[model samples]
Target: MTCHICNTPSNESFQVKVLFKYDVTYYRCHECGFIQTESPYWLPEAYASAITSLDIGLVSRNVRWAPTVEAMIRKWFQPEGPFLDYGGGYGLFVRMMRDRGFPFIRQDQYCENLFAKHFDVTDQPAGKTYELVTAFEVFEHLADPVATVGEMLRAGKSILFTTKVLPNPNVTPETWWYFIPETGQHVALYSLESLHRLANRFGLQLYSDQHDLHLMTAKPINPTWFRWFTHPRKVALYNYLHSYPAKSLLDHDFQAVSDSVRKQPLKDLI
Candidate 1:
């Protein structure tokens, strides 16, 4: 198999089991240190079922952290215009933003909300551009993250994304449940360095805050106060940071994402 991100051959890479039902296997690239499933096929029906079983409340929690995200968004892309929520599931975040008065569009494979639009990152409309685009918990599922992100950059002026970052190099398939290769969904694993490398490759500046969530904002330049945030050791850092005095930022971030969603024209898919 070939490494999806760097296109290097995966002949000597170590294999890790990800999921049980689907029998997914991921290969860790020796050259780029990227972990991904080998020749994985997308089983939409199975994936959809898995997603449906997840708690809706957990998905809605993005609203609680919106303020901090918004502050970062404003610092990066001050003038928020048309925005797109790539892979926005069930329009919960979109609905939250609409309620808060931000005009934005929601696109996902499964969502059918009136406020939602359907779009695939690999097959986006030509000439469509946005002031901001957000994709939370979406990158790890990709087979070719480099190509996927390149398409996102082509479709937007700025991007706000969140995903779990692997910090420990020693935690192998036996120690981490996330590294299991059985489920082909989470093919790519990233660290802060890998994420930054991706941003640099696409000419985007990245700012990441570790809280109960991994909030990452990427644009053409680094946002103000970005240098002050501590690097995340794990996803748990997000929860720890939010418990401190900085918790107020979460509300603001939620408002910003919500406000951006309300301004979008519901009729336009692009």
Candidate 2:
């Protein structure tokens, strides 16, 4: 098997009995440290429900990460510009970001845009570039990781994505909860080494907390703040400072403020 991300030949690493039904084969590529399951024949059944039952924390996860994403944008990316939530499930993150004042657009072919219907990218003008694109918790679900990341790069110069890296060699696949076979949605998994290969292949700089949150950008980020955020204590402090009552600058405005209030010269009629 060839690694989907790096196109390196991979050897069969292990196999798992998915949902106690399908016996799945997993292959690992030493060149990129990428692991992938064989062609997902069970995908239709797996994705019948856009949000799987195993993903119960979907809403809360978006809520919790909203502040973190905001902080990253304030520190690294420009405050204003288009933002897209790729593979944005239910448009929750897009709505949350929009609510927090960022002009976020939602794009998810499989799932319904339940929250941010007004901000669909499909309705927007074509060839519109975004400042940043977020693909939180979506990378692992990709069958073609490289193609998806390439598309994201085209959509924006920077991406803030979330995916839990595979644990060390000491941990066996049977012990890892991330490879939930019942859902059969998580086909590709990447390690830090694999991500670095991706960054190098695409000529992008890679930054991460070495776990879940990661960023790939063509522009240089403030290393000082980036390094600071790598620490859990510092991140917690940042989160606390930005939480409720300290309104985010990107908070969404439901109405068109420009149209609601009359222009000064025209207001005499009212």
Candidate 3:
């Protein structure tokens, strides 16, 4: 088999049962330290429900990460510029970021946009690139990892994403909680080294926390700035200070919607 990130030859590493049914073979690439399962034939059944039931932390995860992303945006990215959330499940994070004053658009072909309506990528004007594109907890599920990352790069200059790196040395479907065999959604997994190769493949600089969060950009950044802003205390303290108060567009959005409601022709309304 071939590694998706580096396009190098990979060897069969192990086998694990997925979705409680199929025994899946996993391949590991020595060149880039990437691990991937055999072409996910069970994915159609696996994703019958786009968000898996095992994901109980969905709300809390979004809540916890929003502040860090906000801090990162204010410091490194265009704070008031357009952004996109690729594979954004249910638009929860999109709504959270919008409320915090970032103009974020959602893009998820499978999931419904329950919270952030009128903000789908499909609703946006064409040919416009974003300041940043985020894909949290979505990379592990990709069948075509290289193609998906390229698609995100085409939409934005910077990519900020999160995925638990496959543990080193001693790793197996039994040892790693992230393996998530029951859901069978985690097909492709990356190590920190693999991620660096992924960035190098696209000629982008990478800053990683070496846990879950990572940023890839064409622009030069002092990695220290990224570390500081992403600290939990820093995010909290920055919000507390409100030195540059968040320019929330809540009222503006409401008024715009109300005006559109008023302008509709009576016959068309019915």
Best by TM-score: 3
Best by lDDT: 3
How does each model score on lDDT?
Answer: 0.57, 0.80, 0.87
Give the TM-score of each candidate. 0.68, 0.85, 0.93
lDDT of 3 by residue, 69-125 (tens): 888887778788799999999999998898889999999988888987667898888
Tens-digit lDDT track of model 2 for 8-57 = 79989888887668999999888778889999888887878988878988
TM value for model 2: 0.85
1 or 2, greater by TM-score: 2
The lDDT-based order of candidates, best leading, equals: 3, 2, 1
Better of 1 and 3 by lDDT: 3
Alpha-carbon runs more than 4 Å astray in model 2 = 230-253, 256-270
When summed lDDT is taken over every stretch of 10 residues in candidate 3, the lowest stretch is 240-249
List candidate 3 stretches off by more than 4 Å.
242-245, 259-270
Give lDDT: candidate 3, residue 151: 89
